[model samples]
Target: MKGVSLAPGDYIHFKSQVPLHKIPIGTKQWRYYDFGPKVVSPLICLPGIAGTADIYYKQIMSLSMKGYRVISVDIPQVWNHQEWIQSFEKFLDVINVHHIHLYGTSLGGFLAQLFAQHRPRRVKSLILSNAFLETRSFAAAMPWAPIVGWSPSFLLKRYVLTGIRDGPHEPFIADSVDFVVSQVETLSRDDLASRLTLTVDTATVEPLLLSDSFITIMDTNNYSAIPQQLKDQLSERYPGARRAYLKTGGDFPFLSRPDEVNLHLQLHLRQVGVEARPDLVQSIPKGGTGGSPSKESDKKKDPDDQPKDNGGNPESTSEESQLPPSSEIHSLDDQLLSDARICSMGHEDAIILMQSQYTVVNRILQSACELFIFSLLPIYVESSYVTSNNVWKFRQLM
Candidate 1:
């Protein structure tokens, strides 16, 4: 699991592609987590915007237990929904999955609808949870998406604990927020902006707006407002198809109201002769493995854990400065400032003066450190990861 490999059951695991084999897919590589029985069964669980394969961890495990083959696709950064769905379709071919049970949430749900419409034969049944038929709502909110991405890392904690409300269908909203925040923390301001722009540019609206399709769009809305003409067309296209509108407040029905959503799905699957196994659904207890870190713990600092403090004032304490060692001073002055670059102040004095103004010098150094440190350590390790033992490594040398 640590690296990419194929197990006996044909499970493909790739942490990262090697230099020779890797092909960049926008900002992120396409990954697939395959699970369940070797024979035919529910074969895919696609997720939505800002979503990663990890989001469907529980679903993959649960469905695998139920003897269903499941593959959650990691979406690449794409400018349009058509391109996004096209890439997903190619991936499906690569995986060689002939038949699929399409399950998607939010944007993923929209993509699922598109996929089924394009290749109805390949899709056995379609399941969309807490999603919209059109992305106008998301496109309208595009400007704010960058703010969410660039906001301080701690914002996730506030949003999860109180800012975001839990719905009956999506119980994992809080956990999902934490995971997304972790991803956002790693993004650069420009990277996030570009991604948002791409999302808005690539959103697919026409296909979803179609009145005739065998797809079901699920959400808290009871579907009462859908135009009767469109509803009639839908019934005519897939006579057995039905719309399920579970009343859940949160956007993530999979997390907050998985039971309710699952129940509805089970009922529909039964109608189509597919059995439901509640026991096969995975349930993660609160504060269980990979749960959100406690607020108090996040703020607390351990004595052993200290970030590299690059602001020590050795020059401020004259006692700590070595004697003028004329030979050393002459050598330093020569290297410090070449004749063409000499400022109004003499090179030797300027050298001493810069060090003397430790306050300003340290401030400048700290700012540079904050900006460049992320490049060196892309993982965004917490302060806890830094320790006093290696503090010297991060110290700004004067």
Candidate 2:
């Protein structure tokens, strides 16, 4: 809730930068940041529980630099999944965005899936990062429902922060976490409780079956708030989803690892035939353009002249175009591995690795504190005389 201050020159720069827009949806106003060109299929960013549209500043600026329209939203205070989806659809309609490429992190990722399932035709692609299918495990781990609605706002904010503060020691991650915590502090008890309810509420989600829409799943290598089991479940649910791993950026990689995230995004966009902005054409390095056909003239070739796959999409005739040139794939693979090492080690090793990093030690400690606090919650609830009837009453109120 802290306002960004700008000097005279800074004010000019800030205004030239992405400007925030407020759209009225029914009685409530939805705030958002819109960037990049209006022509392309816009990359709509949806933030997690502790996020606002501003948190995606790095991604918006970076992706826009590469010629993609990007928009990030401050989700309205709507708790019901179906209602939220309906409101979101109306929001998009108001903005005149017929189709969008979605980039959702954590809670936002879950909502993105719901939106896509509910309105599949409007989605061009999906990028789900550090998100899961359901909240059963999370709800079981932290049984704060009885107290969440009545607890002091700071306590609730602290609890939320402890759970998600895990990230590398980078300044960007630290600053982002700090900003999120600040925003969290501004939430009223009702707002916090509503968000918590939304987090744990169960809903059935079917597999998103949009063939034309590219699907990519991104997660951090070293640390993830999302469980491995949930990640596996997502893969099982979306079989065609291309799995991309980030080496170091932890929960909020878009802020921490913009370059890498942007690369994958650019490649995916090219694969689906979204054109880059003309001004940013030279930003992509020479020799690798995600194997997209370079010449616009090539797109007009005769059907007979074009090679066809079994599925009938155009197939590159030459070996160089068949797949990303081996060199490019190798380079990208090496970068991915270097940036995000997959977690294949034991729990002890993982803990040691996490603790050894001075930058991330505080984050690990915060998570530990969260778990410790969670352990004490049941006792606190018992002492506070919170009963099943009280829980039922609270649920009804919600």
* Best candidate according to TM-score: 2
Model 2: lowest-lDDT 10 consecutive positions: 317-326
- The alpha-carbon deviation from the true structure for residue 315 of candidate 2, after best TM-score superposition, in angstroms, is 47
* Number of clashing pairs per prediction, in order: 16, 3
Per-residue lDDT of model 1, residues 1-398, tens digit only: 11111111111111111000112334545554554332334446776544556555445433434433456665565555556657766655443345667777755666777776666667767776644445444456445554554555344334323422333223234444444434444444444343344444534433333233334545664322223343344334444446777664355555444445554554554555454333322332211111111233334342113211111112121111110111221222343232113123224553355345765766899999998987766454544465653676767451
lDDT (tens digit, per residue) of candidate 2 on 1-398: 11121112212232343445665669656777655544456788898877777777666655655556677887777767888889898877655566788888888888998898999888878888988787777677776664555677777777777787554467656644555665666667666765676677767567776662488888888776678898878777777788889888867787667668878787888877777564533333322221112344234432123321111112222222111112221244554553333212224543445345644766889999999999999998896776776888999999
Per-candidate local distance difference test: 0.44, 0.64
Kindly report which residue stretches of model 2 are placed more than 4 angstroms away from their true locations once superposed. Answer: 1-16, 146-151, 166-172, 186-190, 279-398
TM-score on alpha carbons, each prediction: 0.48, 0.65
